[model samples]
Target: MTSIPPTDFRSFLSSVGRVFAVFFRQGRKARRTRFFFLFSFLPVAVSLVIKFNQVFSGKPGREGGYLFTNLIMLFYLQMIILILALFYGTSVCSEELEGKTLAYLITRPIPKAAIVLGKYAAYMAVMTGMVILGLIFSFFVLNVDRLLDPSLYGLLGRYLGVLILGLMAYGAFFTFLGSSLKRSIFFGLLFSFGWENVIQYFPGSTQRLAIAHYLKSFLPATSSGRFSFLTFRLEPTKPGLALLMLFAIAAAFLALACLFFSKKEYSLED
Candidate 1:
């Protein structure tokens, strides 16, 4: 009878540790990662400066209106998540292939799925952290008087939840694209700024295809009034339906990402 060597739990944990260490080390060397953080914060900073000026000018109502509008637009949140997810998702596997380092990792006694999942988890963590930091800054700027209306707080909470779901869905979608395309970044940008933005204006069921539609539905109706021209100009979904749609989109995209990554042959010199 052939005897199998005992699988050591400690060894498994050590391997996981090494995976994270490698991820962080590579992150430090990736200038794009640093630039992502910088660009993510810039819009939030600009919005805050404008809000402060409004507040000091005895225009608190205007300041509140701007805060409500900016939060609904969530330009900083959406753009940062989309950019990070596109670059990080595609680059995680693509970079390894480019540097010829993927072979070494795959040669180890680790599942390819683990490599993909670990990298995905790390990217999400970094992107989420950047977004939450921006949210905190926005909150401080908007709420300097520390006065909170229950309705406003509730709207903020709903928007935050929707933002999180948007990240998950967009991240998974771009991650799948990264696995499938050599020039995923360019295409990802086009889909984000072009297709999604364009399609949301289409009538009825067509608009439902875009995640942004459901996300906007989750914001307060008063907030929606601010961007009525850009939105579908339809009634916002009920909270329950909006949440369901967001989660459904995330799940569908993640499944597609996993399917592609599991079957595709990743090549270095594409």
Candidate 2:
């Protein structure tokens, strides 16, 4: 197989580093954009409210624990990842265009692939931090007693792993959308809430095309009657295959983003 020259590889690495550094310094833009920080904090806030009400009402603790975990892990946590990934991923390159900085960024001594990939890396890093903080807040606000249980911590770790996998997949897909489409957010929303939500319920191989299909396969099976509406009939995929699917999806989308970015022209006029 042909291999890249060492000098070329080193230059690509350096370009990646430079792009990462610039975006890393500008990471605060994520929080400032349309009150994203508040949206990120929302899961914890709702959990806290529920926890306090349970304590004040002297409700039974067992049921409350279940509610906290479900809300944090299934509802709030997933919502945060989906929403933030869509917003951040779809805006990564578009923001530069909006700020009239695309010309400056593109003119730099960097490979086009490095520019797209670097912004992708920076976006993932920022999302990772936000998701971790949200998880921690939900954990503590639910109750400090959970920290005493080693099994609970182990479970949380697994759940976090699944969430991160989902983030990487969804983030890359939306980033590809942003790079390729002018009205990406609108379509992204449709895919997340409309297509991903409904298509899994379809019969046969048709459902497999959606990202959420693989994600659901990675989650521990639940007899959550409260969320029966969200359940779809499908054989669970092995964890290894599910993880691989997410990685493959992310790689494919990011590669497409790089290809599109390299070919498309950006301008202040648009």
Candidate 3:
């Protein structure tokens, strides 16, 4: 029996460290990262202003303030996540191809899956950070004059879970697209605006084809009473089913992305 050398452990740790280091360094260097932070925070700021004005005026009853606030915040946050994920996910592998740096990275002993996972982990960290910041900001805006209701906290927990699931699903789908197509940006834009927008409004089970349907179901109806016309159109699903569908969509997309990434040929010449 051949004995493995002690150096193997050291090598493994070193490789793991390198993966994180590379992911952070490359992610920071990407130009769109600034835009990611900016867009992510802007909505939170605007919500704060709106909430402050309402609280001072003592006129929060008109538009279902609570519900409208929650929906708008969540909607904007989801949009930011989707857009950023599409940009970052595609750029992770696609940028390497464009720069002709992939060959050098692949030459390292590190598995390609590790590279993908490492970048994905880093991207998610950034995304989650943005969401948390937005959440905190929104909380302050919403609860500055009053205590948060315990029930609202529970609802927030549910919303956060769904937000994460939505991110994973969108991220994996875009990563696969980015890896497979040189024109991923155009196609991703179309899917976000054209496909998702259209499918969300379709009647009945047809809406199930879009991830947004499951997400909207997880959200509590707007409470502000102002945006009655914009309340969630679809009937809410049981929490278990909503969660299951979200995870299922995320898992399927992530698996497909991994499969495509593992076998696809990436070239700078494209």
- Which residue segments of model 2 deviate by more than 4 Å? 29-34, 61-65, 76-78, 228-230
TM of each candidate vs. truth: 0.81, 0.91, 0.82
Clashing pairs in 1: none
Q: Candidate 1: lDDT of 182?
A: 78
**Whole-model Cα lDDT per candidate?**
0.68, 0.77, 0.69
Question: Candidate 2 on 30-131: residue-level lDDT in tens?
Answer: 456337666777878888887788788887554534655566666643477888889888877777777787888788889888988888888788887778
Model 1 over residues 1-270: C-alpha lDDT tens digits? Answer: 965355755555556566667786676567877888787776577667777687677765545545645542556444666777778877766777677887788888865655665666677767777776776666656666655656656655665676676777777777777767778889999988888777777787778777777777775555344444545454566778977877777566656666676678876675
Q: Each candidate: how many clashes?
A: 0, 0, 11
lDDT of 3 at 125: 66
Model number with the top lDDT: 2
Worst 10 residues of 2 by lDDT: 223-232
lDDT of 3 by residue, 114-215 (tens): 677667667766777666666656655666555445665665566566667667777777877877788998999888878877787678788788777777
Candidate 1 TM-score over all chains jointly: 0.81
